[model samples]
Target: MTAPTPAAGAPDRAAPPGRPDGTERARGIRGVQPVAPLLGVLALGVCLVTSLDVVTAAVALGIEVALLPLLRIPPRTLLLRTSPVLVAVPLTAISIALYGRPSGRHWFDLGPAHVTDGSLTLALATALRVLAVGLPAVVLFIRVDPTDLADGLAQLLRLPARFVLGALAAVRMMTLLGEDWRQLGMARRARGVADTGRLRRGATMAFALLVLALRRATTLAVAMESRGFGAPGRRTWARTARFAGPEWAMVGVLVGIGVVSISVAVCAGTWRA
Candidate 1:
């Protein structure tokens, strides 16, 4: 008996060979249109809390945490993605406490590096504010596909088509560089290269990767130019990027969070700046 083939233009029954399906990619707020405005809001929030306002930072962080469920980002995935920032926050706080400008009552004196009440407060505020700002940005950007970001930049922001497409291409290549580096290491191992002399081997591998990257970049530039990327004619987008009510609403929600946080801090007399 002959099996039936998929009809022309019909959706495939199976997922692509190695790529995740749309469901996996669509977990969070999965578009760049909303992210653009959300980013602006976060930037403004960063500025508002830059004066070491601990109460404001805490409130903003609480609000951001409350909104996390709406983004549909898995807690484990989010932690893994933002682990660097999470680790750095404490280290930064410690540095600020140890070496920051001295003010208020002295807490500890270690020669030139002194810890004061003001320095400690500033350190806590700095760490919390970084979390408040960085967490949301990380979560939002994870859901944004490079193609969607390119579309949003070109369509919504009116950026030059060539620049946006070039950025997209570069971002796509970076994701593969890790695998390429791993393969290069494996090749060296198979060739019986001794792992002694770390500096020499690292320099050689880096030079090889640089040469490969330059060649790939040259090829990409040629291909893009051949397709009339930098031409003077009016260009059209393959996908529509909308900045509509939903995008505006997301920005408004973020703005409200910032305002409420500041107001609470001010009323409670914790807003030092």
Candidate 2:
């Protein structure tokens, strides 16, 4: 094999001169990228408070307070664009409220679990905690282009390259599936099969899409294996994570959130046995 010469002024060009490998080029992600400090703080709040750590929860909420200004994201745009996150945030709250451990003085006695002022208060706290924790994570996910995330995870966290990059490729395929799903829905409607009969046909189509998605996932996994995506050798990261001061700042933010969440819960008299 002959060593390929770089194309005129294009240092990273893979093939004959000006041509570059698709993976070699940097891809732009959607939304404003967050500094590592912010994400660190928010994610830490979620992880730390998960163990009912009041200090951690309080710190997480504090970061959220600080982030309201830091994020510069418009409210209308935030609500409309981040609709998925909005849905997720509350759903998470409901889950926590329903599943959280019941404690405190009993206010109303029910058949099984009594609904007490303490329980209501606990539920609200849990719900708030979930809402606070989930929104940032979801927002961050929205802003993070999967490619950048994959690169960052692999290079910064020293994640397994095969797993990280393979997942990134899979993320790209979802765009195709999104279109495929719309077309499938339209085709069913065109065939007069979309009306509400014994349950909506659209629901059936949606189920079919689920199966198709699972099938596609399995197929993609196999295809990746065949295409040397998993060939066991040293892999070089095309993009590197530049850990500036911001990254370390993110770590501190997480620690701060963890401490605060623990403290707040304890002070609020919401800590359970």
Candidate 3:
């Protein structure tokens, strides 16, 4: 047989030296099943919620911060996504410090509100706990695609397909809410109703948005039902959601962090329940 000649413009499939191939590159945490991170977050939250100790929350928060580099999130994006938590933590701490159960020496006092040593400590713990739990969740979810999550829930977790798909649709629709609100505002301005009282304009816009959302939901339900999504038969998934070694390892790491945090708090005698 004659040897075949190379075709013109054929691309090479081989990876360059010291560089990862497509499959190797896809092996990062981003490629793991979505359920793994979801369960991991839940486990971490459960572990932290069991105690109201500064030690546990602080330890967990420290570990989470250390792992931030591995998540490969840009600093600006991380800050923006986690801004809500950052703002909320201070508010939560302030509220708790002022109104929390008082014990030990009092630092400040007002009508039905006191900032004591114990209350301050409790407030700090609560704030840290919220940060520890919320930070990782926001970061992890930033990488999770809604479709992938729905697939994982339906296939790997054995959840009802209808529920998973419905939730996924709802998530997808949430992104449109900003655009919808903008359009509603423009319409109101065109109709000369938006230049009035700010509160009244906001109230009217909110009601309109609510009505639009309900209408969208009804239309979507009808469309989905028409497409046989509401059928009670076995459904085949387009992608297989695998819960293999990597997913297990991710879950294990989160669980280990939780256990160590709890253990440290217990040993330090700071654990409260």
Tens digits of per-residue lDDT, candidate 2, 9-55, equal 88683453211553433322222223463457455655655655334
Quote model 1's TM-score: 0.83
Off by over 4 Å in 3: 1-28, 184-208
lDDT (0-100) at residue 63 of candidate 2?
Answer: 69
lDDT of each: 0.79, 0.62, 0.89
Candidate 3 displacement at residue 167 in angstroms: 1.3
Prediction 3 global C-alpha lDDT: 0.89
Model 1, span 120-237: residue lDDT tens? 9889998998888887777777776777777777888788898989999999899878887888899998888837778888888889888889999999899989998888999986
Give me the displacement of residue 138 in model 2, in angstroms: 2.4
Which candidate achieves the best lDDT against the true structure? 3
Error of 3 at 80 (Å): 1.5
- In model 1, what lDDT does residue 88 have? 89
lDDT string for model 3 (159-241, tens) is 98989999999999999999999999999899988897999889988999999999999999999999899798789876677
Clash list (residue pairs), candidate 1: none
Best by TM-score: 1
The estimated TM-scores of all candidates read 0.83, 0.65, 0.82
